[model samples]
Structure formats: structure tokens, C-alpha cells
Target: MWQNKFETRLELEPRPSRYLLIYQIVLHTLAGAALLLPLILPAGVAFVLLATAGGSLLWQVWRHYREGRGTTRLIWRTDGAWDYQIGVQYWPDLSLLPSTYITRGLIILHLQPVKGRRLYRVLLPDSLPKEQWHLLWLRLRYAGFSEEDVGVKG
Candidate 1:
């Protein structure tokens, strides 16, 4: 209970990250190219595969981010509870799993709802202002992944 208590609540508004979109596109494109550079597949086969993969990736990205699809709200409670909201849907019992990866530039929140499927939310430096981003990173590091909190060793 000691760790859960805090002076003020922390809430964040996460927006779509163009950096992540660009990163995914370039990474996927390079992977597709690499699959062919070794000549594992015939030239014709590789071209077809690469084009198909690239096209699908673009479509998926467009759909996920169109019309502010990636924008969401996150509330961090003093009792160490989290609430997630997107559009008109809200999940009050969404738990932040320990597998989350956080850095100064990025955060991948592995979240699970009490009654629904698990999901991962991407938080990027550009998602918030510099000060808020820093505060979020600090809270995640100390409250979310602290050794005394999550009981992860090594």
C-alpha cells in the first residue's frame, strides 16, 4: 500500500505516432527486401511476395491510424490502478502487465482487461509534451516496473 500511495493523479492522452508508422513501414520494407537479397526465392516469386507484404502493411497502418484511431486516454491512480479509454469505450479494470517495455522515446504498455482480450498500446515521445513524457516514464519506471512492485528478479 505504501508504494501505491501518491500525491497526485497522473493521466495521459496518447496520440498516433507518425514516427512509429514510418518505422514500421521502413522496417517491413527492409525485411521484405532481405527475404529476397539472399536469393532464397526466385526473382519473380520474391517480387510478388515483397509487393504483397508491403501493400498489406500500408493498408493495415492506414486503417489503424486513420481518423485518430491511435488516440486514447490513460489514467493512473494513486492506488496503482489504471483506466483506459478510446472513443466511447472505456475499460476501468484494465491492468498494466509487467511485460511492458519503456524508454525515454517509447513505451509499449501490455494491458489486459478484466473481461476482454489483452492489448498493447504504443506511447511515444511525440505523444505528449516533453515534461509529461518524462513524468510518464518516471511513473512507469518506479510504479509499473519497480522490482519491489512487480516481483521480477534479474
Candidate 2:
């Protein structure tokens, strides 16, 4: 769309990650088992307390996951600014930190504002179609490696 423009902004819309879903299921199942482990271990107040603690933790994680933590739509500008949409909320104008990690199999975007908690979005291999993923990966790598980011330096 911006073939005539100097700088290109990127928008990557990846479908929900099945790998992430699987990971979440397995991880939570293991945690739930751990929470129930006390039942099989023995009968004691301490064991019950331990199980309760684990259950509480599991509940918190599950709640967080259910509340808009899966699948992201990311928009990155050439000026090191970015935004993302999680679930139905669009988080805008977050600064993209240089700490972002990009690799062949995965990509992690480190997004944060001037005063707020840091946020991260992880992109797995299956996040997008093969060709799209390849192109996106190339663009990310290129952007990260570019010194000036824009052609004309001010």
C-alpha cells in the first residue's frame, strides 16, 4: 500500500496459536494434578493447605488466560512505536523496546509505555501461514538490524 512511501509500517495478524493452547492445557493440567497431589500423598492439615495454595495459583493463572491473553494483532511503525489488539481491546502507542527477541522458530515483542507494566507477546511458528510468517520474520529482522530505521536521518 505504501510502495511510494519511504517508511513502511507493519501489521501482523496471526491466528490463535494451537501450540500455545496445547501448552496452556498441559501446563494447567499438570498444575491441577499438583494441586490434587496432596490428596494422594497423605492426610494432614499442612498437605491440605499446600493443595489449596496450588489451587489458588492455578485459578489465578486460568483466569488471567481466559481474560484476553491469547492471539495478538500487532502494528509496528518505523519510529519504534507499536500497538496491539488482544481479544477486543486495542492497546495503542506503546514503545517498542530494543530488548525484543526475534528468532527463526519464535518471536517475542517487548512492549511498554513510559509508565506502566511491561507486556510481551510471543509468536510461534504456527502463528501464521508459512509464507506470511517468513515475510514477517524477514521484515522484523530487517527492522531490528537497521541502524537509522528511516532512509533520511534528521
Candidate 3:
């Protein structure tokens, strides 16, 4: 049996990648278009939908910016436990292994907390060396997650 000696620490400060910027622009544009639906549909119904969608979009954007602006610290202990902290917020210990989603040059970590799931998006900027990114991924995989837990966007 192979005993794993896992002890690593990583600090990540994600920047806005071009792909992320484009995606955000497209998403906000779609939401803006939905706001015009009141012209076609019943005013009351359209207003409700518009409000819901707009609020949801704004909330998502706010959360994204908040997560991206800070330095996220991840620690993998030899005891097979993980610690994640962003800014002053210390997230609860991950009850379940995280799933990874790769899309448009961004890697998203979907962490299953005690309650629901939370997403941490890492925007891969061109300035970041590919070697470092590979090392980070390898460390994450070695910590326990497997390829089966990864999903790639088409």
C-alpha cells in the first residue's frame, strides 16, 4: 500500500480572463434583452420575470467579483484534510470531495459543503505559466479527486 504524504499550500488570486469577460458580457447582454420583454408580453408578467432574472444575474456577478478579488488560500494537510480560505472568510471544511469543471480556459471547483454546493472559479490568465497551472491541478488530483470528477465544457 502506498502511503500518501500530502502537505501543500497554494495561494491564488484570480484575474479576469478574456474568456470570462466575454462570457460575462454575453450573459449580461442576454439579461438586458430580457428586460425589454415587457414591451411584448403582459406588463405585469414581464416585469416579474425581468426582476427575478435581473436580480439573480446581479447577485451572481457580485459573488463572482467578490471571490475573484481576494487571495484564496488552500492548504492540504498530511492528515487528508483540506482548508480553504478567501480574504477574511474561512469556509467550512469540505464534507465531500470537490468536482472540477473546465470551460473556456477557466477551471471551476464545485465544493459540496455541509448544506449545498459552492463554486470557486479560477480564471486562467495568459500571464500565468502553464507549468504552475499543471502543478496545481496535479496537487488537487493527488489530494483525492480523480479524473472522473472532472467535466469539460464543449
Candidate 4:
């Protein structure tokens, strides 16, 4: 017999995905190759291209590290509305989308916000204890999210 009641709050510390790391490596490698093109072109033109690529790579790395450093909190209320906080952003009155996206090591929750773009929160099960992850998964399903959306690996 499973209890219908669930914990009111859950705090998840997400980890960076290895796949994302690999993708970043590939992206930087391609950028590095592009940066070498300045050797064959005019010095001024090549400098601009090199600067642009270098800046883009630095920005991507900074964003990735920042995103992976915070704890995400989910707070559910009896009235059926939920609040999600990640880093400094707060989302209230969120509804779970009907589908969930699960991958090799990640479970993504697609949330519908009351007045903005849909939000996707990624969870790394490997970073959490199995029991805790299972509990969170149960609570999500209990809240009306479906597991039928589990095929895409993004």
C-alpha cells in the first residue's frame, strides 16, 4: 500500500552531464580549428575572427559552470500549485507537463509556467541516492506528470 501524501519540498543538487561535457569539448575543438584560419588570411581580419571564437567559447564555459553550481528546490502546496527555485530564478504556479523526458542518466521535468516560456529542469539520478530519486519520481507522477514522454535523450 502506497501513501498518497508526499513531501512538500525537495532540494536537488544537479550535476553536469558527461554528454554535455563531451559536446563542449567538441565545440571548443572546432572553434580552435577555426581560430587557426587567421594564419592564412590578413592579420586584422584573422584577429577579429579569433577574438569572436575565443569570446564565444569563454561565454559557453562560464554559463555551463554557473548553471551546474546551484541547488534547485521544488515546493509543492496543497492547493495544487508548485514553486521551483533554481539559482536566483523563482517560478511559481507551475504545472507539470503531461510528458517526462528520461535518458541514460537524466530525468527531465518539463514545467508549464503561468506566464512565461516552459521550463525544463534536468535531474541526474546518478548524483542522488536511489531511494531519494525514486521518491522524487513518485511524487512527480503523483502530481500528474506522465512517464510516457521518456524516449528523447536530450
Q: How close is candidate 4 to the true structure, as a TM-score?
A: 0.60
Best of the two (2, 3) by lDDT: 2
Question: In candidate 1, how many Å is residue 45 off?
Answer: 2.4
lDDT of 3: 0.58
- Count of steric clashes across candidates, in order: 0, 0, 0, 0
Worst 10 residues of 1 by lDDT: 145-154
lDDT winner between candidates 3 and 4: 4
Return the lDDT, model 3, position 27.
Answer: 85
lDDT for each residue of candidate 2 in 1-154, tens digit (9 for 90 to 100):
1122117776777765667767766765676666565454555764676666667667755754664356568887666577888777778878766566777887776778667888888788887788778876776666454533322111
TM-score of each: 0.77, 0.60, 0.58, 0.60
Output the worst ten-in-a-row residue range by lDDT, candidate 4.
Answer: 1-10
Residue 147 alpha-carbon offset, candidate 3, angstroms: 3.6
Against the correct fold, how does model 2 do in TM-score?
0.60
Model 4 misplaced stretches (Cα beyond 4 Å):
1-9, 15-19, 34-51, 68-70, 76-81, 125-130, 137-154
lDDT of 4 by residue, 1-154 (tens): 1123444555555565556666777887787787675466887777787788778778877876776777667665555456888778898878766566655466777778878998887676655667767766666554453345334443
Sort all candidates by TM-score, best to worst: 1, 2, 4, 3
Instruction: Give me the displacement of residue 12 in model 1, in angstroms.
Output: 0.9
Q: Flag the better candidate by lDDT, 1 or 4.
A: 1
Using TM-score as the measure, the top candidate is: 1
- Model 1, span 17-107: residue lDDT tens: 7787778888888878687677866888888888888887888698656736545788877777678888877888667777777766778
Give the distance in Å from residue 120's predicted Cα in candidate 1 to where it truly belongs: 1.4
Residues 53-122, model 3: lDDT tens digits: 7777677677667756776665544554445677897765543344566554556665555566564646
